[model samples]
Target: MAKDKTGRLHVTVKTGGKRKLSSKLWLERQLNDPYVARAKREGFRSRAAFKLMEIDDKYRLLKPGLSVVDLGAAPGGWSQIAAKRVQAVEGKGKVVAVDLLEMPEIAGVTFAQLDFLADDAPEKLVAMLGGRADVVMSDMAANTTGHRKTDQLRIIGLVEAAALFATEVLNPGGTFLAKVFQSGADAELLAQLKRDFAAVKHVKPASSRQDSSERYVLATGFRGGALR
Candidate 1:
């Protein structure tokens, strides 16, 4: 590692036999990313913690004494932040995380190895939470197929499902936030959110790579009850 003129560390990975150029480039990017280094030093699970931190700083979403539900919460970075902000560690609030993959325990977060897409997931999460949630957040992304259209569609489907689940589980005037890509499918989702929530907006945190199309849809002030 060498320091550049701008005082940023630059790491170059040597590509050899069996090491693809893409993999080498990706490793180099990760090695040089400030957020990745910060996450490691600060004990967060992944660099994605910064993204949520940035968003919440601006939006004031997470608060003490609020129940939060996190969907697709593997690796638990977002859950870690949620738990801390909501004071779940001190038992002032509740944070429940669900993912298809198993996650290690966080002090205040309850982990569930369940798929959010399952028919029973919403009910189960409500039961675990003991009531409707003050906020429902999802950082879920579908497995990419390498094709842009297919990947966009899959991600949209996941966001749609997450939105429906939020409607079912969020308390009146609650908030819903989810990761979404810049794609045509977002129009319909935005329209639906507008109807269900008092305010809806899109946010792209500075922590997110500029080249990535990923953005978060934030909806607040839920109308409550079933969507017509």
Candidate 2:
């Protein structure tokens, strides 16, 4: 894979002998996906990088030298982008990336392998940063159980926990972005974000696959409301 100035990745297709239908379909899709090609070309670990980039481009959450936290950072796509931009700016910028899976090393990014739901996780993240973060972003999703309601509820739980964590850790005017579902965020969660942030909006970036129901909630301008 190689990248161009526009951050587009180009990958060469390799033909492997006969494969299962699903595998073949997946391979074909990957070969044709512009985001996947762009990611590879640009040296990003995953195609999800475009989602964060698009979101930031619209909301302007990313700033040089600002502390940022990335949750569910497996493969470190978002962290990679954040690290590159933040490191370039110098200053006090830092990125703390956490996931249950190991991520390849990236300059200027701290990786932690731990469950965010663990009681000590927030403290661990804060300790790593030495301070609150300017941005708290989460792409965490519960493993789908194939039951629609069950999956949605479990994902909502994760988002709610992430939101609560943000309430505790975000600096004033901080931003929070979390992946949600087509059903949208829970009413209570949306209400809480509205109370805590100056603006709360839901967005679906074009980079996100059309068939996927995934959406994102972007909360900005933290008000430092009651976290506990």
lDDT of candidates 1 onward, in order: 0.91, 0.86
Best by TM-score: 1
Model 1: residues >4 Å from true position, as ranges? 1-5, 183-185, 226-228
Q: Write the per-residue lDDT of candidate 1 for residues 1-228, one digit (tens) a residue.
A: 788778977998998999999899899988988889999999999889999999999999999999999998989999999999999999999999998888999999999998777888878888999888999999888899899889888999999999999998899999999999875337888899999899998898999986788899999999987422
Overall local distance difference test of candidate 1 = 0.91
Per candidate, the number of residue pairs that clash is 0, 6
Best by lDDT: 1
Q: What are the clashing pairs of model 1?
A: none
- Candidate 2 local Cα displacement, residue 150, angstroms: 0.9
